[model samples]
Target: MHEMSLCENILQTLQQQANAQQYSKVKTIWLEIGELAGVEADALRFSFDSVMQDSIADQARLEIIDIAGQAYCSHCAKNVPIQQRYDACPECGHFPLQIVAGDQMRIKQLEVE
Candidate 1:
């Protein structure tokens, strides 16, 4: 799954942050994952343990925050919630929605020592 690669990226970010912030170990990672990002949470969790083995973040707790997908509909002229890409606007049933939020994954916070 792509989650494995995503975990690798996360590990790289952790390593870079550890070096920049002078932290030796990571205790926890707060990840904000958007629903529209198309990432499976269970896959990410499983991949995290494997990717973190023998690393500074080994055994670190992963705290995931699920972000709801949001978009703006020009036809309706209002913001609406969406579950997937290309979802029809709920208010107006229109295409070509302007995405406002979601569809991204990012590290929000880290607890390190």
Candidate 2:
């Protein structure tokens, strides 16, 4: 799965941050994942634990925070929760809404020791 590659990226970034800050070991990692980002949380969690073996982050705790999808409806002139893109706005029942949030996968924080 791509989560392996994702974990690799996280590890690489963690290494950089740890080295930059002169930290020897990582204790926890906070991941912010968007609901519409299309990344599977369970798969990423499993992959994170599996890929961290024998590494500095081997014993690190993984915390995933899910972000809600949001959009601004032009027709309704209001922000609303979006379940899917290109779908009608729930409140306005209108299409062509501007996506304000969601579709983002980022590292929010890293706790090291």
Candidate 3:
């Protein structure tokens, strides 16, 4: 699954941050995952443990913050919640929606020592 690769990238980022910030260990990671990012949280959690083995972030706690998908509906001129890409606007049933948020995955905070 792509979550494995995503976890690997996360490890790489953590390693880089550790070096740059001079932190020896990571205790926790707060991750913001948007619903529209297409990432499975369970898969990511499994992959993270596997990928972080023997690394600085080994056994680190992963705190996931789920972000709701949102889009701007031109027909209704309001921002509405969405579950998937190309979803019809909930308010006006418009086909084309301008995505406003919930399409990103990022590290929000890290507890390190």
Count of steric clashes across candidates, in order: 0, 0, 0
Model 3, runs deviating above 4 Å: none
- TM-score of each prediction: 0.97, 0.89, 0.96
Candidate 1 has its poorest 10 consecutive residues by lDDT at 84-93
TM-score for candidate 1: 0.97
Instruction: Report how far off residue 83 is in candidate 3 (Å).
Output: 0.7
Better of 2 and 3 by TM-score: 3
RMSD in Å for all candidates: 0.7, 1.4, 0.8
Q: Which pairs clash in the backbone of model 2?
A: none
Off by over 4 Å in 2: none
List, residue by residue over 7-49, the lDDT tens digit for candidate 1.
Answer: 9999999999888999999999999999899999999998999
Inter-residue clash pairs, candidate 1: none
Worst 10 residues of 3 by lDDT: 85-94
lDDT of 2 by residue, 56-89 (tens): 8987999999899899988878899987767679
lDDT of 2: 0.86
